[model samples]
Target chain A: MRILKFLLVKEFKQIFRNKAILVVIMVMPVIQLIILPLATNFEVKNIALAVVDNDHSDYSRALISKITSSGYFRLSGYCNSYNEALVLVEQDKSDLILQIPPHFESVLLRENSERLFIAVNAINGVKAGLGSGYINEIIQQYNQQLRSKLQVPGKFNLGPTIQIQSSNWYNPNLNYQLFMVPGIMALLVTIVGGFLSALNIVKEKEAGTIEQINVSPVKKYHFVLGKLIPFWILGNVVFTLGLLVAFCIYGIVPLGSLITLYTFVMVYLLAILGFGLLISTFCDTQQQAMLIMFFFIMIFILMGGLFTSIDSMPDWAKMAAKFNPVSYFIAVMRMVIIKGSGLYDIRGHLLTVLGFAIVLNAGAIVNYRKTF
Target chain B: MHSVIVSHLTKIYGKEKKVAVDDVSFSVDKGEIFGLIGADGAGKTTIFRVLTTLLLPDGGSASVGGLDVVKDFEQIRQTIGYMPGKFSLYQDLTVEENLSFFATLFGTTVAENYELIKDIYVQIAPFKNRRAGKLSGGMKQKLALCCALIHKPNVLFLDEPTTGVDPVSRKEFWEMLKRLKEQDITILLSTTYMDEANLCDRIALIQEGKILSIDTPANIIKSYPDVLFAVKATNMHQLLQQLLRYPERLSSYAFGEFAHFSFKGTPDTDGLVTYLEQHGLKEVMVKTADITIEDSFIKLLG
Candidate 1:
């Protein structure tokens, strides 16, 4: 315990002494929290839609008017021909294009049938898919209005219909901030925790202090543990601070008990600290440690299901994600925050994270003592 | 019992079979300052690491204070204080903090062992609040010494502790070690400075991962086995060329301001002076100077 205390004090002194860490901990988190969420959106709102009405009759004009009035599509331009609409899309001037067939008024009245063409920019697949869905809804609504006007009888004919009613729990509005805040909390904590611990040991190597410890009465295990615990606690503190900022600034309230959240976070920190220790042991310089950690953090965050859903991934990718500790932590955080799942519900995630912590720490302890 | 001991200690770094410390065996008696003098990459640091239990030898065995380095590694760690070649204390912490921290690590207090490090620690104590990283090269050297001695280890292993420090600091550091020797602590120090070899009770001049000579500095210098002389004249370049041309001059090498030479047999100083005058030289000085450890080191290498 005394050795642990000495190490903790040293770790604290090291962390608080660096102005760079102060900026990363106190300032960077706020900046990212404020700006990152505003830029990240999957709902595809406020799409810029354009239309070309070659059929200059009442039928085509009415269809165009319905599309323009729809809340989903923001009509920014009315082109004269297909070529002009294509030009707008190719130049990235518009997200979607709606074209009405020529002689649509004559054909709709005589034949009781008409066709409308919808061309969507597929460069951004998600935005294009949403735009196509919006245009389809508008055309269906206009056709229903025309049918009601030519009503035959009060009796209705039976037909097949498909409907999807999604009941989004906790965050019924599906606020992206609500989903992103917890994931970001995990990412920030992991990064700072891993980075600082790696630097702590590597700084020893750089300054030649590891030699002092190496020659001193302290055992390698004592040294490695002394280095790990302080950062583990710090990682938790940063994790909690980030959670508070999420609540205070973004109004993102966690539905689960804070104790459970903290418990999972503590377990998660072990894996991160282990990774940092491993990096420090392998690297001779702090710069090398930082670069290697930056690479690891990049891969972990990108594959951690922070912004993307793991369930939506391909089979092999999802299988790979199952082995990723970040994926489970993020999934567990979302489950608890959005669904308020209890320990029993998240027991699998807890076990996996616990196993990861043990394996990584074992590897770290063994590798950390190795001579360079 | 020796303060530190090793027998047939060999360490191979990798599968490629690079031998760092090869069948090395040495021991230091208690209360003695021993020098392991060598050039860079001469396995001096590797030997220190092995004895400190920082690295396990691929073969053979070592013990510090009667405790096996590998079998009783923890005991060895508790018994020794190591200062590596690089300045390695917590730079963020102040001098006092680093000293106090290392003291506490050994289950001891700075106050409890104040006498053990009082002299060296006092010199840097005034700046106790200043961070270790911000201190000057000499101050950092002192602070490292104070921290290493804080625990009052039975043996101290300093691996080239004064490598980059200024000469004055190096001199002062040696004086501190001389004082520490009174406390009966075993000191095993490695250095590249041949001058420092004289300060040790016994010195081992090492090269290419091999011990070339091990003896008291006086004895090593005395055993040069030749008639050595220092000769300097006007146009040293031309003088050196002429000196090397003589077959009677067994060896000749520049030493500071004068050229040191060894002759195969007794040479007439007047005859040599007349020869130099005839060769068109001025301001010639011929003198016999005491050989230093560096002189012996070069001779041993040769």
Candidate 2:
């Protein structure tokens, strides 16, 4: 234990002495937290729309104005014919084109019905899907307005018989930044802790300092722990800074207990940093460690359920995600921050992380060969 | 009891299938300066690493202070101080921090073993605040030695500690080692410099991962089989070529300003002088030379 204190002091001193890595740890994460949340938003807005009116009637004009006034679409082109609207879409001036049939108002008054055609550019799938959905909602709202104007309560009732009154429970606004920031914070923590600790023992190996340590009476567990705790503490520190960024920039605070959040981060870091030392033990050079670390981290980030929903993934990837420790932490982050989930809610997640921490660390210490 | 003992130690690098140390054996008496003298790749460092518990031998056994290197590895580690071939002190750390860290690692304080490293550490005391990376080669060597000795282990293993050091610093380093020897600390060091071999109480000459011969410097010189003659001509390179072509010449090599020549049959200086003059070589000289360790080593290589 006394020897471990000295090792910790020496490790910390080395970390603090390297100015470039220090900046990468403490400052780079803050900048990434600010930029990634804002840049990686999923909410697509400001779709361009083109309109064709065969009957320039009040109904047509009202519908046009209403769609424009919804602030979701902009009037990019006005086509005199269906062919012209097709041209507008072809020319990339519009994402959606709404075509009203001839005698549209007369048909509505005479037969109490009308038909309209919508052409959407489906090259960019997400934009096309969301854009057409918004147009359909506007048409439905226009039909209700026409019905209400036609009569008082006895004559006409156009309101839906059963209303949804849909309210997004946790994230009322559906702010993508709020959803994305915590996961990005998890990624930065992984990078800082894993990258640094991955190079720790390998660095000593390259410098030949490991020979001196191997000949000394230092226990393998003491050496592994001495390398682990410093980075684990720094990982939490980086996590705290990320949380502060989330609060100051995105106004996101964990609705769950802060104590529970920190407690899980502590366990989460052990599995990650211990995995780093595991890589350190297997590699002979820092470059090899970095390459292997890069490979694992790339897989972890892509399959971590940070960007794509795990539920949407195919069966095989879901099975693989079960093995990814980042997936558990990301779920923990979302559950605690957005759902206000308590510790009991995350009991299963805690068990998995605890298991991972024990297994990865045990593997690292066992593989750390005392002799060359 | 001997501070270190080895019997038929063998180590093979599994990947390359190269034998790094092959069936070598030696022993170091307590408090003696035992030098393993060889060029680079002579397995000197490999032996040091194995005995220090930094490496395991594939065959045979070794012990430090009567403790088996394999079974009592932890105990061996506690009793051995190792300074590897490379300057392995933390380059980013201050001199004092590196020393204290090593001292504390062995469950001792630098203050507790201050006397053991005092002679070496005092030279580096003024630079205690400087980063070790910025020190000169000699200063780094001294600092490494100080860190190794801070725990005051029973035996010291230094692998080519003077390989890259400057001349003045190398002399100072040997002086420090001589002082440590007086305190009855068993010192085992390896060096490629043949000149440095004479300073050891006993030395082992090794090459190609095998021990060629092991004895005191004077005894190895006395064991040279034939009398050596130093020959010189005005044109030295051509003279060496000419000496090799001489019918009676068994072997010839350039050493400094003279060509070392030996004859298979009994030599006559008058006969050799007549041959050199007939070959039109001017300013010819030949004199009987005292055999040094290097001469014996070259002769033994044959």
Q: Which candidate number maximizes TM-score?
A: 1
Instruction: State which docking tier applies to candidate 1.
Output: medium
Tens-digit per-residue lDDT, A96-119, candidate 2: 999988888989988999899998
Worst 10 residues of 1 chain B by lDDT: B267-276
Candidate 1: chain B TM-score equals 0.94
The per-prediction CA RMSD against the true structure, in angstroms, equals: 2.6, 3.0
Worst 10 residues of 2 chain B by lDDT: B268-277
The residue pairs in collision within model 1 are A208-B88, A209-B88
Report the C-alpha lDDT of model 2 over B195-233, residue by residue, as the tens digit: 899999999998888899999998999889998999988
Write down the worst ten-residue block by lDDT for model 2 chain A: A155-164
Winner by DockQ: 2
* TM-score (0 to 1) of chain B for each candidate: 0.94, 0.97
Candidate 1 per-residue lDDT, tens place, B210-296, comes to 788888899998898876789999788988888887667778888888998887778666767777777888898888867989889
All models: lDDT?
A: 0.83, 0.89
- lDDT (Cα, 0-100) at B125 in candidate 2: 98
TM-score of each: 0.93, 0.91
